[model samples]
Target: MFGDPIENPKGWPRVELDEVLDGIDSGKSPVCLSRPATPGEWGVLKLSAVTYGRYNASENKALPEGTAPGQNLEVRPGDLLFSRKNTYSLVGAVVLVRETPKRMLLPDLIFRLRLGEPQMLTASYLHQLLMYPSKRKEVRSLAGGAAGSMPNISKGRLLKLRVEVPPMSLQEEYARVVERLEQHRRLIGAQLHCLEAGLDSLQATAFSARL
Candidate 1:
């Protein structure tokens, strides 16, 4: 139901990213084991988890055995995550967490976006708006770093950047549509996976049987 973000046919009020935020919460980086977290183990979120516009809960490293979990840094359902530092092209990546595995915490390079006005700015809609190709371009321009290093955006710079905010009703509607489309995509992906598996099995049987 939404048009190209930059078009702003709805002509919603525009504001800086921080205008609707109480404050952004950043997590700390801690030494952790290389393996993905096993059930019952606490894990630190990897940057890949929030990259490419998808939240991959499996993309986390286990905390070293017995390391106290950072309770406050845990990723919550419905939290909108933002990558504030990364390679030039991926620095501004963002994702919305639908559900999360137990004990997964945010890392230093990522941010949990906290909305000051949840009534006005829903995480689902904000996630959709931020990932637009046009919006990515604007966000990337805010990143800065020295030569040969990853680009990063300071909270101050992000606060100064502008974004258009549609009315709450339209934003909520957009979120619902996006969720439905996402569900459809996942169903199709599952069907394709099943088909591919069946194909592989049939191919294996045929080749082994010399039919």
Candidate 2:
């Protein structure tokens, strides 16, 4: 639910984060009662599961036998996750969930964003914007708590955070750019793996010769 919408300039539209998001809710905080789970067991997500630009569902540990996985705790693909509480630097760390394996429930410390209008802003574009260095710095500065322990951004502050919203067309273009960049990244990663293997073989041959 958005507050009173702000009028935009002639060209670029600006909106508070709440304007574009339908809801922001954290998950159940069940006590960690068991070790990390196998592939099919019910599990609880950890704060570490939400990394910048990535999600590791495997970071979750198994729930105890009697713990109830609360309603609305399941994190589906395409959900945007934010760390509401963590060390100052890690607070507000966000990630796009690309996949969910088996039954994984969202943990209390992580908040999920429910988009109000997908057409107005693609998830990719908003994700890129949030992870932008300037925004990240702003988020870190806003987080509040004790000196050494977990800092937190209140839900009110998060909703009030302002964001620039360009035209939908421009946002789509940016999404395409992100897609291409990801493709390029995967290609480069494969090439680097090959190069590393080649180097390892060369080192092995050199060691054999010395022997």
Candidate 3:
């Protein structure tokens, strides 16, 4: 029942990620016992940084000096981060770094990708591809473990992921479309949160009046 699909869409290129990328790496775990750092330092990003296909800076954790640099991994703006271990639905969640403070670090369970030619593969496109249902299924299948627990995708499997690349212009266009959709989703989410907060406040106020 599968329909015939175009092998290569016009203005698109068929290429694997390894072909156009350099230095695909993940972060190291911070030492829990490390001392705290002074003010004005870098923060460490956990899987919590990524949510619903976006980066949430509000939830990031600050790193102490011992885990800041020469002790922990460093990340930068424009780098792509992926969740390596999480709930089935959260696994493979991706985010594009929009800003970088000094000594930014990623936890061991997350991956950081540094693109060789940023023009060739836009971070937005990569994020979309990884979030695709088919790709997520593939990642889940590769995950090894017992049922009902967090599963992990090995480094070898991650590097071997096949990515279909579109031309830079088309990629940018797709990114814009995805971005618009994401904005709408975020708006809806905010509205829901506000509604929930209002309901909670009303309930509390009513209870207080009765008291």
Candidate 4:
């Protein structure tokens, strides 16, 4: 039911993504075995790190020493990560890194983007845009191959994609509004979970009394 309220908003700058951001690069695949640290010494993240527009750090794998640096992609907080190859349904999946523990690395299949100007393109706003369904569909349309196993949208193509930008102040305001909504949603979810658990417990007690 959410509509484009920004389309008609005054004082918003309608700009392409390339105009506001830079350093749209993909990660490289490190060699299977190299010198640095073993598989256990380093934390390696794959496409699985991204789920429902959030980064699940717990799913990350630990790499031991001797793993080549080139095999893993280097990413930092504020970078946007996307899955380059996936089925049509899952292609163009995006996640924004809120924070990363020291020396975290991403897998080769993920693309990392660093915003050129924090003021121009707020990470929170861009993260919301990346999770937008329309944007995901647009990216998926650019997917190559008939099998749909490798729906690869190149960095150049991604750079060329257009995005509407609002003023920094407005973006920050919007982010705050979104954050409040998310908080409310989480609260409702928690209440639902508690009710469900209570019901289960009551059912178990009744069964025991009958026995």
The lDDT leader among the candidates is 1
Q: What TM-score does candidate 3 reach?
A: 0.68
lDDT of 1 by residue, 127-198 (tens): 877888998888899999999989998888887878787778888887788889989988998999999999
For model 3, state the Cα shift of residue 126 in Å.
1.2
Alpha carbon lDDT of each predicted model: 0.87, 0.79, 0.68, 0.68
**Model 1 residue 29 distance off true place after TM-score fit, in angstroms:** 1.5
How well does candidate 3 score on lDDT at residue 162? 69
Candidates in descending TM-score order: 1, 2, 4, 3
lDDT of 2 by residue, 19-113 (tens): 89999987887787557867767788888898555788878888877777775678888888999888777788888776578688888899898
Clashes of each: 0, 0, 0, 14
In candidate 4, what are the lDDT values of residues 154-178, reduced to their tens digit? 7777777776676678778987887
| TM-score between candidate 2 and the true structure | 0.79
**Ranking of all candidate structures by their lDDT, best first:** 1, 2, 4, 3
Q: Write the per-residue lDDT of candidate 3 for residues 51-88, one digit (tens) a residue.
A: 56667654556665454353336666677888878887
Which stretches of model 2 miss by more than 4 angstroms?
A: 1-11, 183-211
- Which ten residues in a row are the worst by lDDT in model 1? 1-10
| Cα-lDDT of candidate 2 | 0.79
Error of 1 at 12 (Å): 2.0
Ten-residue region with minimum lDDT total, candidate 2: 1-10
lDDT of 4 at 106: 73
Q: For candidate 1, what is the TM-score?
A: 0.90
User: For model 3, what is the alpha-carbon lDDT of residue 122?
Assistant: 82
Task: Tell me the deviation in Å of residue 137 in model 2.
Answer: 1.1
Q: lDDT of candidate 1 vs native?
A: 0.87
